[model samples]
Target: MREPADLLITDCSLMTPEFDILDNQYVAIRDTLIIAIGKAEEIKDKYEPKEVLEGRGKLLMPGLVDAHTHTCQQFLRGRTLGEYPMIWSRILVPFESSLSEEDTYLGAQVSCLEMLKSGTTSFAESGGVHMHKVAEATIESGLRGAITCSTMDTGPFIPESMLASSPGEAASRIEELYRAYNGAGEGRLRIWFALRQVMTSTPALITLMADKAREYNAGLHVHLAEHRDEVSYCLQNYQKRPAEVFDQFGALGPNMLAAHNVVLSDGEIALMKERGVKVVHCPRSNFGSHGFPKTPTLMQQGLSIGMGSDGAAGSSLSLFDEMRVFRSGLHAFWGLPIFDPVVIPAHELIRMATSGGAQALQIEDQIGTIEIGKKADLILIDINQPHISPTHRMIPTIVESVNGSDVRDSIINGEVVMKDRQVLTMDEEKILYESGRALPRVAVRAGI
Candidate 1:
């Protein structure tokens, strides 16, 4: 005589962040939330399901969370390779400047398609020009996370297209944006505050935007300490490291998500630890010659680290690619003859993409894990293929072997947005067609 669940998934290899693998378990969803979770055989007949999903060969976990990305840069992928150091000035600036508001929206729309196909259900979009376009795209595509405008008022070599006219203008834009879009898409999207970076924004802009973030009770996102040259610049200008610069403004805390801490020293890491700042590690972007962040050292120090793709510009849109590359990054950290589990185990790596990512955005209590009473943001990866056959352990098989394309289904907020690898929210063919046509226009406009 109980109310029925809208949807039920049975016989799933349910993986939770606490390292519990509930083989042949079931989950129930109703009204944008998980109403029940239990053994599949036990609960198969308990409630009538409007739509029952057979998950016999599927691996279910909280959908992968990209802690930091630039959906607006989705169109610029594969073009800026080998242009690092000068990439921003020579490549990104012009490309970003060339984008119309519609262009930004299309980039976000296409990025969301890639993310959905790849098993990412939630992602924090780093600030970009015309971010309302991002919100619109997120709402249309049915993903969850923060989006923001690039808050810049001062700095050198910044394109006029990206610069705000005044400090007041930047602050006002953030306030207005938060007021308008902070809780859009039924509370899935949060419009947070962002400063382009020290190299682009004046300290005044950072302090103002930081104050605005605190005022609105919103998370502040920024790109910091990505390169050694950035650290040198901070030291010469602010007379401190990047972490010290943020600390001086009282802007280092759980409310802050610092992306790409590849150049932090011992003291800087300690400062981040002392302030409880979370980090988003874009492994592939800072991969190869630039070197990965001192992640093993930081993880040992108890810093909560999350994974990100940094958009098509820096890396792939798939968090699964980031996950595989993350393991490789660890292997490189310890030199030759790597024993993977000794440094960082597979499950812990999985944590960085799930719960760790949610914690980075200060929303762990809501999403990031599979639990009763939590929002049902889940991905079901069909691992019955040749590469992933003989799955001995759930987490290891997922972290080590599986890639994003293996995601057969993606569910956000108890709604099946994608099934059998076909996205239900948007037009994939049209999006692909649009992107094909759009990229040429963008390239010609940016003259890249």
Candidate 2:
């Protein structure tokens, strides 16, 4: 007598938003939202499902969200290792400035496939060129993404081709991108405005883009105070820290999504909290040599924080690795300094990858939890493997032992994008082949 459900996973171990582990549960998906979650007997009696998955040995949880990434940098992987500080100005800019439109699309394909295989269903792109191509690649890959174009009006390392003639032109281009791709891919895609970094951005461009983002209800993405160079640059130019400079430009607000943030004063942290700004921590990307982020401080202040892989160029597009690296780094930096053994709990790490990331992207209402009416973005980790076989503690085991290879299935927007480690939406072999053929050209162009 009841309508048919789209898909159902029966007899699974579910991790709730509150980090509670529930067993012998069934989750029903109808269209893009989760329609039912309860005991299997009641769910089976209530609705007929078109397809059912056996989840006996799997842990079904909300999909991981990558809060910051550079899809266009996949082609430059391994090029920045052991390099000097400020690789963005020395190597990253030249590499990105030389990439063709096709190259950008290929890069996105590589990054999206990696993310999907690693259990990330959604990501927020930091900034890049040919974002339309990036969006097209993301839509084809069946992943949710917040796409943005790298906008710059002034400052050094300004590639002649990348620098905008005027701040107005840069803002106009961002607006065009938003209008074209804001809700593309059946609302799985969002368009945000970006400033590449403080050193490369002007006050006029910052204010204009912020206004446009507020107008469109989109978020503003930027790399803020990632290292001492950025902080020193802001101080020399604007006589304030990076966050204060952004605030003076009328750019810091609830809609701002700041990445890195490794070098912030107490005042800057307080200012961010007061303005309700969201923060993304890329531990592997920023904490290698420059400095560590004030994540514990940010967490203590109740600021919404998320995790990111940065990209494959220097780091990787895997939240699993990010979690391990973040946990280990936090233990050494903040934990040892204060002599506290538990700086960040394992469950909190998982929450940052899921619900906290969703909050940062302003999509918490639609995704990030295994609740009714939320989007069916979820992943299944096969715990039947050897490493995780004797899993006594679910959260700690997932944090310390689980790798990206353990993700067996991925579902986004009510569709199975990957099943049994095989991706349904992308041609893995074809992408690798094309990347092999194309990497040489990109490398030669980039002079790497």
Candidate 3:
């Protein structure tokens, strides 16, 4: 008993988990939500729409969701490559200390443009040093995101301004952010809590962050077990694995989303599954840092696994590239013909980058799928190109073959954010110019 749809998409291949292809379909959308989906003729007869999009020779799928990213790090993309984690940290913390508010905003604009052009509709951003700028940029870019004010308390690596003076101060700042932005921009933006990293944060601070997040009904994002050195450091100092310590602090839950859980034990995987805790597997970041693990093992254990790019510094912020790496790398690791790298499959890869990531952010019901009552977050891929021609299998081809450049349009919350590969929200040229100007200053400050 809802009103008729405002828009309809017709004659396209719609990707779904149960089946890869649906032909000549029409998806009805109204007020930022999908109202109905069916055969073109059937839906056209059922619901009158104000606008109809011809999806002929195009693939219509839910928009990609980046489970983990540092939006403000796009300016540092190529600069941080080839350095170990410790060296990476040394360069990053000092560089971040010198970033002006204008620099932060410009960096976010560049990152948002990159994400949208690459077909990402939603992202979870661990906003560096300045959270307000990151939130403002996300709002301006027409991208949905879970933004966190990164908290660090340790004396090592970072300046005092970047670290919270005390645990109480950190909690207070998080409360202020939650109160101001938790449901801002008509729920397009959400505020979450970040504990920075285990090595730098105290046990008391971790427990307090968990408590605050629960009180606010918000999600917690953190990095865990990304490197052997991280594990060794935790073991040497805390006499516990990072995951176990987090578990002791009452931090494992569906609301908690851990990034790069690469070095977890079988027991830790079991614990994550039992608690319904989700993980963002940045295969590119893992390969760059500590190499890939048996993620198929984590998947087999029924833990929700989503894909991430980590950041420009960790990997190029393209989910398409991540999917390609995932398919080939998992195949290489298993090396069994019947194992079928296709078992995880391309359609599922798209799903993980979209719906699975939304679930990790606890926004699945709102923005992940293109179902009735779900947000109209979707991407249109131009399959008419020579490389993507004769699309016999649309979903698989999209995952395996489609690059970010093939994204013809990106729609978020019933609005077209990018059309014909042109970004609508921000001035891309100005962003690039300002970012170029700022990078040299940042490099000099870090002595890179």
Q: What TM-score would every model get versus the actual structure?
A: 0.96, 0.98, 0.94
Report the C-alpha lDDT of model 2 over 1-448, residue by residue, as the tens digit: 9769999988889999888889889999998989999997779788888888778899999999999999999998888889987688888877888989999999999999999999999999988788889999999999999989888878666788788888889878888887888888999999998888888888888888888888888899999888898888888888999999999989999999998889988899999999999989887988775778888888899899999888888877889899999999999999998889789989889988999899889999999989999999999999888898777788888999999889999999999899989999999999999998999998988788
lDDT values for all models: 0.84, 0.89, 0.81
Clashes of each: 0, 0, 0
Q: How high is the lDDT of residue 159 in model 2?
A: 87
Off by over 4 Å in 1: 335-341
Which is the leading candidate under TM-score? 2
> Whole-model lDDT, candidate 2?
0.89
Tell me which of candidates 1 and 3 scores higher on lDDT. 1
Best by lDDT: 2
Instruction: Residues 1-448, candidate 3: write the lDDT tens digits.
Output: 4357777787777876464567777888888888788895667778777877778878888899999998767767877668866644686666677777877888788889899999898898865867788888889999999989777888577777788888889988877877877777767999998787887788788888888889889899998888888788878987888888888888877788888888988888888888888888887878777877667788788777788898887667889999988877767766455666455667667767887898998988787776778899998888889888786776677767889998888888987788778888878888888888888876676566
Candidate 1 vs candidate 2, TM-score winner: 2
Question: 1-448 in candidate 1: lDDT tens per residue?
Answer: 6458889998988886688887888999988888888885567777788887789898889998999898878888888777756676677766887889989988988999999999898998878888888888999899998888877776577777688998789878877778778788888999888877767777777788788888888898988898877778888898998888887877777789999888889998998998889888988887743676788889889999988888888667888788888887777676335555557678878899999899888888878899989899999989789889886776777777898989999899888999998999999999999888889888888887
Better of 2 and 3 by TM-score: 2
